[model samples]
Target chain A: MNSQDAILPIAIPLAGAGVAMLLRGWPKAQRLWTFGILMASLAMCANLLNHVFSSGKPLVFQLGGWAAPFGISIVVDALSAIMIVMVQFVMLMGCIYALDAKDIAKRYSVFMPLFLTLTVGLTGVMLTGDTFNLFVFMELIVISAAALTAMSDDRSGTEAAFKYFYISQLATIFLLLANGLIYMSYGTLNMADLAIRIKTDALAGGPMPPMFTLAMVCFFATFMIKCAAFPFHFWQPDFHAAAPTAVSAMLSSVVVKSGVYGFIRMTTLLFEPFAPQLQQVLMLIGAIGVIYGGFSAFGTHHAKRMFAYSTLAQIGFMLMGIGWGGTLGIAAAIVFMVNHALIKSAMLMLSGYLASKAQIKSASFENIKGLGKYLPQSGVLFFIGSMALAGLPPLNGFVSKMMVFRAGIEAEQWAWLAAIGLASLLTLIYTMRAFQWVWFVPPAAGVKAKKDGDSLFAPTMLILACVVLGIWGESLVSIAMQASEWVQQPAAYIAAVNPAK
Target chain B: MDIIISFAIAVLFATGIYQLLRRNVVRSALGLVIISNAINLFLLAIGAYDGTVQSYAKAIGVRSDALPLALILTAIVISMGGFAFTFAMLYIVMRRYKTADIDAITELKN
Candidate 1:
């Protein structure tokens, strides 16, 4: 294995975060440092993706050259590589987006450090093979996110961060307890080793203890909050809406995704036997989240909070996709994960861009009126994202939504199909209502029209990518299928981490 | 002895949860600390091979599993850091808003 490929996705950002903070006195240097680091990480992910795909197997690197199930192991499979690529790409854009925001750069010296730490934590989450290590990285993520949330200059930012921090702490406790239970039962913390033992037990006709199910339940409860599904989704709107625009892009696009990623990891790799039952429960909650988020989106006139609710709804679709339970169904879920990251991040950034330009301070529906005619570029970007999210034809959102429909039909789940259909209607309503209110409504007098510049680069590139994905839907679908293969076939992942019998 | 330790853990966890659900930010921070200790106890009790013996034993038969001890050590350090961060944030939140009640701290438009 190329050890650099296994390690640099995390190490580079960690090293850069230190350098960025040291050079905090120089904002320009910080920007350059952040951009260079993200680009390097992106490039590394590209190389690793090529290596993994060409080798036609996952790559495992045991830290300190220790054997599996003993020392820490970092596994870079198709799914991990894909997620790294997505994260690095968005982070690179977030850096550029942050450059234009200027508010963050001027006020906070720790932005680059916190951003890099967040990146490191997330990268660690994707790569680690040990559940304990996953917990460690998760704590790192929570701390970094909490600090960043508090970094927001507004009182709302503090409040939102406070809420997020507590919820995360509660999740952390659950995860730790689950880890204890699993460790006590299995005698080893390595995921592949656990999977091997589980298989061995099943083959030997041994029964799973009730404790196993209880542990799984605890783990599931944690990720549900992470996914912000259903009842646990209340904190999402306030947190996302209060963050700095670029931070919102990161949070909405990839940070929240760690939860969904955790759920997928548990179901496929560690807890497959209980998945059917858990996924059914997830399916019901997902439907509730979908409808709840959609209905809640209509109640908010602020662009950011509306999108936050919409994200809750999108998560429902992804969960429902996972719940559909087949190769195509899981693949569809992965595809939507990718598309939502792209489309939603772009939408959130566009709102921030518009907010900066508006006469009103925030992206409220009332203040940002006439932007469709006045600021045609942002209006267009917002419209495209809105249409895609609302599942319009010829958009990337429609592509993934189509796959979800296909997955539902193939699984013979008419109820899921009908639920998705209803959610789609609600999505169209909120998105269009927001769009119509922004562009078609008359502007208040004395609104200062701001000109678009290099700042437009972030949303434009993002929207273009979404459009490209839509037009080349076939390629995206096939790639998603390959990634989901990592989750669909547990043996592939297990074999990569533990090659020896 | 085992049952007692387990009951104690439950009580600590319950108190932590209750304190967290309180309206004040300081109570929330205190709850965090309390919960951290509860988690440590939970891991310790779960790792115990014998409730009758002392936690550390060099003698082979009476020895406790060392893994949870190491894990607890790491968790303690991490939780300390977590507590420091939380307390510092709490101070800042209090100073900035001039209030400890979280309900009164609602300024962000949702």
Candidate 2:
């Protein structure tokens, strides 16, 4: 891709963000501005997706016409295009949901700009040829997340945001440190350049330095925190439950995926240096996260908190595919990642509607009873979303879940496959319980207002999206497969790194 | 030069651990800022501080290491934004609940 094309998708949102930030006081006008920005993003992403689908190779653009390795470059391969597409879809839905909110104008004004900036950062991370630029974008996303999380004036919101900010900042530092070490060793932060140097020099004589292992370990830890894996997930429930619904969707969908994206990019591009061990470590962590998150979700009563725990479990399934280390497994992982992003964002939005009707933002199971009778549409929407999350057959979730399980079997990891099944069952238990209590059980008479304003407007769209995605998942899977092909063949990425070749 | 890096890491680690263990939200946030700085220093050191100019010196028959500098500069700005966020959080907590201790404010349920 030429610099003009590569720069537009990133620049359009960034310029929008600049304008939105400047126009903060006019909350009423902010929605129009955000709508415009999201539409532009959607268009650009669609154009990029079309271009890639027609053209078999990845699009490479060196900024300012500078050559790779010496100067910064951006490459939009299949994975980049797919991720951009997913971000654009969820973000568009998020803006629509926010626009329906009445008192949230000021919040929307602040959030829209940050949201745009975060998009630029995430897309930039995925497309950038340089590893160090990945760090820059990652920081942008992290900082924006911190600000977004704390934007809520509530007690739990601020507290959760602070915890998330602290741990994530620590994770960023570790990432930066790892990037520095890799640069010191290779003298270039371009991933393809590093791969080539590692291939040529290490293949000839020298033992692969311990630096490779340490750097991978540091990188692993950083992403593990970002993904909210089993041990480092203390902040997940708090942040997910405390933040506003739209923000929660962003956290679950785009922000968390940033970490998974990093792990996939690193393992695919840099794993050759320490190939075998990295895969093994990833598999071990993935398997553990699967079991741990599922079982933990089983015990949670709060609606959104349970969903947060479930998010960790789903991430586990995606990571398992990457760890299994083959074209098929990686493809399965990519499909699952995209599927989760769609469904989970929708689930958060629906949860918001349920909370608003109850006149309490709390998502406790007991508080959710008989909402189905009062608001039939949101109740049904939540049920469908819950089913998709449980990996029920024919839904998008089931297909991706099946792919991950198949990948495990293909790799001959029978025990992990069993764990995956057990996790699926656990998912069913929690999601069914949440659905039953929220939709079926009768609420205590006169506890609160049973009906409310059109708060369900935003959440309903998310539910509609979830249903459509569940029914028509094959189209998404096909795109994921195309992305997997590019990931499997690193030539496009390599060309971006070493254009002379 | 090495001492500077070590001191920064030590201070950051100490402050981070202290704040992490505290009940006060503001203190914890301050500790996070300190730790983020330490991490940036460590990254700068690992990227190789040539004890001269920070750049790769591309103009003087030598190229400045733009990659590390760009990343660190970005990191610095991000931390500053985070710092501002922490202050905002503190203000919210103070205004709403009149408490800076995270444990004291428990209105929102999990």
Candidate 3:
């Protein structure tokens, strides 16, 4: 497909969002429109993937038919295609789970459009090949996500939305500043053109300019903040745990992954000049985040808060894997990301059900008890998701975690690898403790477990997806591995970025 | 001129960080405004350097950099929207939680 076709997937949903808002009073219209947008996005992603692997070339779409270094362009390569598929798949699951909820149905008119807009922004971020365009896409995604978080309008949701929005704005400014530094240095905003220009002008001749390094550092810093890396993770706990569970799932699973996506794209395509040291720094941060987040999760009493911290720990593992900087490492990161998206979303859904059904506002271990007897289906699904999250053998998380650990060992980054392994143990302990308290122990004195079984189906479907994916993870891993191979070999991607050459 | 923009950004970032660490909402929101403006200025400064005109009479084959200008405009709009959001949030927090102090608004406390 041409660039015209490439831009349509994102544009269609974005346009549909506006249209849905106009039709806010019609529930069926909202569902049809939003689902149509998502379906179109999925089709576009699949088509993009087909073009990427089979052709082994980058697909470049110059907006308004303008050439690069003048007009902004969007580029989709293997890595972008992979991310598009992963994000779309997760959103599809989220939409399905959401559609089934009665409360969600009530809010469908407003929620669908906002969610679609977020999807458009995320897809745009993955595909755009321009520095300034990346910031534009980031702003779009962040704004929509904040709007969605606040859609529920509860105090907690509003609070979480506020925090997420503020911190995200800070990160966006960092991103904008970095883009500015690069443009100042290179006089070009297209990423592919910037890469070539920077390489030829800056890297080839005299000592690499201090400004280049400064820009690199700023870019890395912004991405770290966006990914909620350790030391800049202050916003995540409250934001992730307090938002409605579906939003929590999307935020934890896919939204933050965009940061990792940017890092992977930048490191592979442009920052390869300093790959070794950059990888080392990323790995160090990831290792520290893993250990820190795991312990914090272990210490937390609130269930959602505990899992929120656990997400940081899991993201640490993904970043660490990516830091290894090879086909296997990047593939490992992708696989782990897909698995986390599945399991984490499922777990949060279960948590939401518990909150709605049992009036358990705190999500403390003591607040939930005898769930196995009261809501056996949700209990079992949650247990499976929890076990998967903790990297239990034969479960999905274990498969991907093992791949990442193996990549670490292959890269001979043994210390961080060991840290990850140790973090897994902490993860196991905290996870089991949660399971024991929520599902096994008797209810605390007075609170009664809701006996109605109507609400368990959404979480059950989510868990079923996790199980199926776990059982057939190899197929997805194979596709991911191929995509990673394309990313690692950047000549094709570089060509796509500067197709005029 | 570059140095001035850089210095301004540094100050904005530092102030934003400091206010972000504080326990008040309005102050942090104001700090965010400063930071957002600083970033927008930084982007615009980068796009417009010494000896350049903002507009182009398009000689079709001739290349010029106007994309950054467009981006800056977009950034301006986005930051303005964010500013409005922060102000509205401040209003709601003051009314509902009875304070704009983040520390005092811990209704969702763990």
The 0-to-1 C-alpha lDDT of every candidate, in the order given, reads: 0.82, 0.76, 0.78
**Largest DockQ belongs to which candidate?**
3
TM-score list, all predictions: 0.95, 0.91, 0.92
Candidate 1 positional error at A238, Å: 0.4
lDDT of 2 at A3: 43
Kindly list the per-residue Cα lDDT of model 3 for residues A1-501, writing each as its tens digit: 565777766887889889989988887778777877788879888888888778767788878878876777877777788788878877876776666554432464678887888888888888888878788889888888887777552456777788788888888887888887787777777777767766676456677655778889888987887788888887888887776666777888888888888788777777776778888888888888899999999988777788889888988998898899798999999888888888887787777677666654445565666554566667778778888998876688888988998898889987777778888789888888887877778766676765442256656766787787788878888988988988887767767666676
* Predicted structure 1: clash tally: 0
Best by TM-score: 1
| Span of 10 residues, lowest total lDDT, candidate 2 chain A | A100-109
- Sort every candidate by lDDT, greatest first: 1, 3, 2
DockQ of each: 0.52, 0.50, 0.56
Global Cα lDDT for candidate 3:
0.78
Candidate 1: residue pairs that collide? none
Q: Write candidate 2's Cα lDDT for A1-501 as tens digits.
A: 454686677888899999988888987677689789889988998888888778877777777777887777777778888888888778888777767643242355578898788788877877787877777788788777767776663446776776677677778777877786777677777778887887786678777666766776888888889888777888888888777777788888878888788778877776565666777877888888889998888898787788898899988888899899787788898888888888898888777767766765556667766666677777677777788888886677888888888888889998888877877788888888888787677766765544444366555666666667677877877777777877877767797558686
DockQ head-to-head 1 vs 2, winner? 1
True contacts kept of 3: 0.54
A370-422, model 1: which lDDT tens digit per residue? Answer: 75567777778888989888878788999999999898999999977897788
Cα lDDT tens digits, model 1, B2-109, are 889989999999999899888988997798888888988888886766644554554545645667777788788877877787777777768888999888776674
